[model samples]
Target: MPIPDGPTTYRELAELLRGRIEGGEYPPGEKLPNIEELMETYELARQTVRAAINQLASEGLVRTVTRKGTYVQARLGRRRVRRNHVVTRSRAGMYIFPAAAYPDEPWQTHGTPHRSMEAAPEVVAEQFGVEVGSEVLRRRRVMSPEEEPPFQIVDTWLSPQAVADAPQIAEKSTGPGGYLERLEEAGHGPISWSEITRTRMPSAEEASLLQIPGVLPVMEMILVGRSGRTEDALEVTIRVIPGDRVELVADLVRDASAQWPLRTAEPKE
Candidate 1:
């Protein structure tokens, strides 16, 4: 195919290349045009072409080898997360609830979870309605699909009251229903969850662990668990996942005013 037009900016160059990759012009595992060729075709400078390539790499669309050219990365399967009810039961135990969404797709915690009492970060403190640097119990783990690279880094922060009431939460395994169940047993029953999501670039550690490029933005989901008894939030969970690999599904309910009917005026004569 002929080069249609030259891109003036690096972003434009990236978009053009992205179109080609998504359009199947450059199939997965196929090497993209070399920097020199792309520079010539787009009438762009080497720096601009490199920047474009870097952007694509950050978005997980392509991979660059040490000596070989950049190749298109395989399209990853997207995982859907139902926003309303994320947890479900399984024979093994209670998990964060992906089974109902994709029962056949196997997922598990990637490594040993690290738990400690640490100073709360600003965001965590805000969610817990505590002062920054206040002590909180933190549990960090990497959750991934079986036989696949890590995709999510989860950090569960618990309030002091929660820990005091449910001492079992500090153990390596929280029996059966997981932390939520434990909280319920401690009279913090009938827990309600609310979540807020935002996107930001990953940290150095996150990028390394997730095997994603630094430029890629990740979706950070902050979920708060509150007890029916009190207004205070009992637990906070921060889930970070690659933006490209996950889809969030939520059900929207309409109010009575939105009900469909013949409420419109008649046509003018």
Candidate 2:
């Protein structure tokens, strides 16, 4: 068999394949040619074809399955992330609730939390109202979406006392409602929480974990959850969300029943 001259560079091959996928030549969910087939058809080197497919994967345009083949990636739905749930906007904010970001249907992503003991960082200590370098429980969790690769990472720091009281918090999954529910059971029902948000390019390690393109920026949120009027926060949560499908919201309303924190203040001149 004779091979026709084709694009010589991986970039050129990637562009050609990208055009075909986007132009419906390959179609969504359609299996792309294997490495050998791609190399034979394009008359390109094996490395060149592999590199091209990898490029497409990085762009979220295709997915490769083990023992199977690479297929065109379907458009992914954006996840909802209520900024309010992440943190309260004002002092009057009472009660902390989990941000319901996804549909009521079974959640697609499950998180595996890794726990360890570490000295509290400056920021974390300030939020927890503890001395810097105080011991704390650090829980790092990475989440995977169903049938897709991992896309999010989270970190939660708690006062060592809190963890000691709720040993289940150290488990990878703390049953339904997760850590928050466990905390509540341990007598740390959060009355309120606050958050700060930042957006920036991912670190090399973060980019690798999330499998996001270098150009894509991620949202970093710092959330502090408190119970009653205690100056010591029960936990501080940090969420790293990649991609654009997220919303942050906070509601500041005074509850008539009870108020330990977020006191009403007089207007200043």
Candidate 3:
């Protein structure tokens, strides 16, 4: 095959392959041409071809097996996680923690949370208004679709005051509605939440646990749960979700003064 017009750099090669994948030329689960074949066809070096494949892999478009070769990965539809702050209650009148947002999909926790009293990480300490390494309650839960690669890891850190007020929070199960309810019951009722979302490459441990390539970015949502009583944050929940698996959606409503359709100005020639 003649080399296509344009730059023959690895980035260009990646774009060409990306077009093929998106255009259905290389359907999901289909094996891509071997590096040698791609090198020959594109008249590029083996390293250039490999780099292109690596680019696609990083974008979650392909997976490279040790011996089998690279294959297009099946797209995992992104689950939309609403930014709604309203606390919800189940039909059984239990406060429901928003875990898996996918409706009708069976999602489960990987195992019982690993609960321990450990020094707070920098971020957690900041939220707790304590010096770094201050002892705090920590609970980590891995959530996933049944028999599937874990998609999210929720790490809940509670300030010393929160645990002192609601001891049940440190227990195996804070029955119905989870710890939020327990905290509320302990005079921390009417809890409010604020969140910050950022994306970064996953840590090695995170990549191994989520079963995703380190190149794939992950979103870290820092959720601070506070109350009216004091300025200190009561709890901080950090949600780590793979880039390919989840999307955050929030409804934005214009203020009363902002009209939907603006009046156009008259032409002044």
* lDDT per residue as tens, model 1, 1-269: 33666688899989988999999999988999899998888778899999999999887998676587788877776877675655555676554533213547777888788999889988889878889999899999997877777878989999888888899998888888788889888898778787788999888888777767677789898888888777578899988888788887878997887878736778899
**Best-first order by lDDT:** 3, 1, 2
Per residue, candidate 3 scores C-alpha lDDT tens digits across 142-183 of 998886768899889999999899999999888877888888
Candidate with best TM-score:
3
Candidate 1 stretches with Cα past 4 Å from truth are 1-46, 63-72, 80-83, 86-101, 264-269
**Could you tell me which residue pairs clash in candidate 1?**
none
Q: Could you tell me which residue pairs clash in candidate 3? A: none
Judged by whole-model lDDT over C-alpha atoms, candidate 2 comes out at 0.71
**lDDT of each candidate versus the true structure:** 0.82, 0.71, 0.83
Which ten-residue region of model 1 has the weakest summed lDDT?
94-103
Give the alpha carbon lDDT tens digit for every residue of 23-122 in model 2: 8999878998899987778788898988888788766677676688887866565665444344322233333345524434333444445688788878
Which 10 consecutive positions of candidate 3 have the poorest summed lDDT? 95-104
